[model samples]
Target: MTAVLNAVPETSFAEYEALKAVLDTASRRMAITVVGEVNTQGRAFAVHVATLGTADPLAPAIGFFAGIHGLERIGTQLLLDYMRILLCRLEWDELLVEQLRSIRLVFMPIVNPGGMWSMRRSNPNGIDLMRNAPLSAEGQVPFLAGGQRIGPWLPWYRGRVGAPMELEAALLLRVVEEELIARPVSFALDCHSGYGFRDSIWFPYAKSTRHIAHLPEMYALKAMLDGAYPHHRYVFEPQSVQYLAHGDLWDYAYDRVRAPSVFLPLTLEMGSWLWIRKNPMQLLKREGMFNPIKAHRTERVLRRHTDLLDFLARAAYGAPRWLPQGTSRQHMMSRAIELWYRRRRA
Candidate 1:
């Protein structure tokens, strides 16, 4: 007689359950790949990738990532909600189908299921995936927040020195290389929560404040967003404007990418401090600071960000139309320097 296997504990997690449901509903339209796995508490949790649209090498692409820090459940929820919205629209929206034909959309919503399962910021190994990259800060970083080699016991640990990157980090590298990096122009939005008082959208160069080669491109994108959503509250700035950190995965990825092609990686640090101020008691709970405890608050957060996710897809779809060129590009670069860097000096 064949014995039936019991459900894995991770399968019971709400995020994983939502993931499975999305896959099951959209499997015919999406190319789902099990990129890797993380083991914790004797449970093996799968890292899933869901891709929509064409994989044309020349087509622009956008990747949406979340849950790198397990305790930041809002990140995962926002992405999952966005995916559900897209999938719901796909059944009847000809505009969406036509758009999908022109560009690629990639999702890796739950990057660190093991960490999420344990409700920890770092993975089961106690290493922060954001800080697990091989690159180091070009200059001094803020104490432990910059990343440390003080072993897994401490937060912001970078894993053992000279060791291979964590599995989640490797999988992210491979996904970007295959989807976004290969395209002529692409963007990545990695969602995170529990940062500061204001919702912020940050670009690369987390290792230093020096300008990126694609500053002009970044400025153009910011301009488009500003024009499109004038009342939007996100504070768009370079990650270094806040504080430099060691081993930022996006910075490492941007440095490794060769010239000529444009790749913009953004981190969406949702402002959980606002939630804490609204519900002051949340600060007392372990995971509360990183997530909204009330159902209505969570729904509001999801409603606010899904439009931005949709906007990125359309932006990637129409990149050639708005991406600056020649003299316009030069002017934007100069303006970017004057706006961001010069203002910092003053």
Candidate 2:
């Protein structure tokens, strides 16, 4: 049969089921609720939420998600991998478990279920969900889209001025409003991919605002993330302004709540190329997902898996600013010791 990860029927199901499991575990590991969802194209998509370390419901939280664009399947898969780690790797990451016990972790694994099934970037309506966030009354993509020049949403289809959330955004923002934002969250992150971009941990309104007070925290967090995976440059900044990404998820998060929000485009830096073998855009029918890799096996990809676990564990357990340092160096050291032992044995 076709090789897929776990019992995940496809990447879409992987997102759905992972959220279900995370929500279900909240009952045992923390306090949570279904939060709710909106069905598009007959699929029941939801934004799952959980609370920990307090009763104020509006307490600060750390959120993670994938599949907003739909075509960005790598993130969709990575989030799924995260769910499994959050659930099953409790022993391997006790510090992370303790951290989760302290800070609420909201997982919106599939923001565009319709797109997940179709392998498109936008939601089912052919709208780019990233650009679909709520916009100003004048209808712009926020301060970044194109300066005042690119008016009224074309080329981006950012959505109408007053449209609620473009589906998922509304639901997610609702959860934050009722729970995290109005309450206490001081930090949060949104995961994405593309550009094969390096050192891309970015903040909102990359160009305009000089909310410099927060730069140190951003750099500290960035250094921790970079240390976790040093293969790429640590490209952290306020994000660009020429793109004027209005109604963006990060824009809304930063502007409304003024939290230290991060948009991590964790693009893969390895030799692997997504479309080189099976096109990332290919659709799946009854015949099964086209040319997908079976769930990763062996240590070759173990570091990617480890990097994720480490990031979450560090976020949950270590102080928000600290991460394991010299991981690449540590690996080399361990290898050298092993080689020495082998030579001695010979």
RMSD of each: 3.7, 10.9
Q: Would you estimate the TM-scores of all the predictions?
A: 0.96, 0.65
The alpha-carbon deviation from the true structure for residue 296 of candidate 2, after best TM-score superposition, in angstroms, is 4.9
Tell me the TM-score of model 1: 0.96
The segments of candidate 1 whose C-alpha lies over 4 angstroms from its true place after superposition are 1-11
Model 2, residue 280: C-alpha shift (Å)? 10
lDDT of 2 by residue, 1-346 (tens): 1233367753345556655655566466555556566566666665555544444354345555566666555555565556555666664867665665555665566667776666665566656666665543233334433323244333345655555557666766666555555543344445555443241455655323333333334445555666767874435545542233555565665556544432222222222333223444333332112213433422223335446534643454344334223564355434433432234346
Local distance difference test scores for all models: 0.89, 0.50
Error of 1 at 118 (Å): 0.5
Candidate 1, residues 1-346, lDDT tens digits: the string is: 0011134343447787778877888888899999998889888889999999987889899999999999998888898888888888999999999999999899999999999888899998899999999888878899999999988888999988789999989999899998888778889999999668999999988998898999999999999999999999999999888888888999988876787789999999999988888898987899888888877898899999988998889889889899999999999999999988899989
